[model samples]
Target: MFSGLITYLDSIRARDPAPRSRWEVLFYPGVWAVGLHRVAHWLFQARLYFLARFVNHFSRFLTAIDIHPGATIGRNFFIDHGFTVIGETAEIGDNVTIYQCVTLGGTNPTNGVGGKRHPTLEDNVIIGSGAQIIGPITIGQRGRVGANAVVTDDVPEGATMVGLKARSTLVPAEEWIKDFIPYGTPCDEPCEELMETGAGRLAELESQLAEMKAELAAIKAERAQPIKRNGTDD
Candidate 1:
């Protein structure tokens, strides 16, 4: 693959170049790699199956990136060129930017006779390049997955996930997110809060009423008792 040679060249350049201008002419292997990927996909779509397949294999060998031709990708699917891998079953949303070294793969390696082996990204989800989303979980609309996070389960709508197992750390719309289970601040639901407060107040008032009735009964009992004797003859 051309990418492999480029990587080796880049590495050698890094080591052998003069210290003053070592990185002056940095070569980006990823840009051409991604651009080539798009072209290969285009070839396949245009019915040049054999050439497309060859390009795909070669690209992977060189760039360490393997994008499945069958994967449904929307508009503006840009990935920073590098060791990136996208699975055959991966479904990418529109305007999604994937950085280098990201993996959208399956747990069992073959997509495992899939019913839904890869993650389904919704619209406007910004995955900080290097995020790995595996399994058939649904990442809700506008969710953000932080860099290098390993996601295995479903993420709630408009939430931000970081760390391993991808726990929802923040919800952009607090009230709309109730599935935040990991260090998530309670969503602000004014109506729900008001209902709870009202219910609590009602219980307190009922207790106060019961206590007042008991006091009134005690006073009446005292008045009806021995006080009658004081109202006697003299």
Candidate 2:
């Protein structure tokens, strides 16, 4: 666990998350999560709901991640980076990898009815950052969701979903697949001025097109006008 911290600190150039150096009590995030979640799960099982939530909140605050008490996360569930949030009623299968900004959320808010609203993740499911999975859906085993994808329905096992309202893409066995699709992790600067210039030009052309259309309409009206009163052609 201490080594996990070392690796994590090395991974990011930001400030350290912990000051503890004791090897005995120290644990890696994977180990810590597995261990702590077991305890939290027990607390939840024992109906210590409030206390479990409190501990879950603390874990998330300290780790920059959050998992709700009502969530049933299986063994070896892993999360990387910050801004990951799991809903209370979410059920995660074993070996799920959740990246940053991923949300396993509830679809329609509960209006006091006691039914399942959160999505269920099957084993080995991997979710990329900024992905939203809503509704009482089942993401089948080994299913992968791409970055920024918004899912509201069921996904079959081993299927990959992408785009805004994510649709599944069937993958062949030969393809090299990754748990999380790489997106939005860029630190390099982009050509903003060039993009802005192109946008500006497009806007200018649209404005010119509108003006030309107006002028053409005025000319047509002028030509369409019959000769005034007595001046009208017989």
Best candidate per lDDT, number? 2
In candidate 1, which residue ranges exceed 4 Å CA deviation? 1-34, 42-50, 109-112, 172-234
Local accuracy of candidate 1 as per-residue lDDT tens digits, 1-234: 667545634433432333244243234454445556677778878888788778888878877778766566764454545678877667878645566688888777564566667888876566666788888877777677777788998888777776676666533355444322212223344322344344555677889999999999999998777534566833
- What would the TM-scores of all predictions be? 0.54, 0.62
* Reference-based lDDT, residue 131, model 2: 92
lDDT of each model, Cα atoms only?
A: 0.64, 0.68
Q: lDDT by residue for model 2 over 1-234, one digit each (tens)?
A: 767655443432222234344342234453354445666777998999888878887777666667777788875565656677777779998767776788888867558774788899998777878999998899998788888899998998777777779876545454325443333122222211123344555687889999999999999999997767776774
lDDT of 2 at 193: 16
TM-score for candidate 1, residues paired by index: 0.54
Lowest lDDT 10-mer window, candidate 1?
178-187
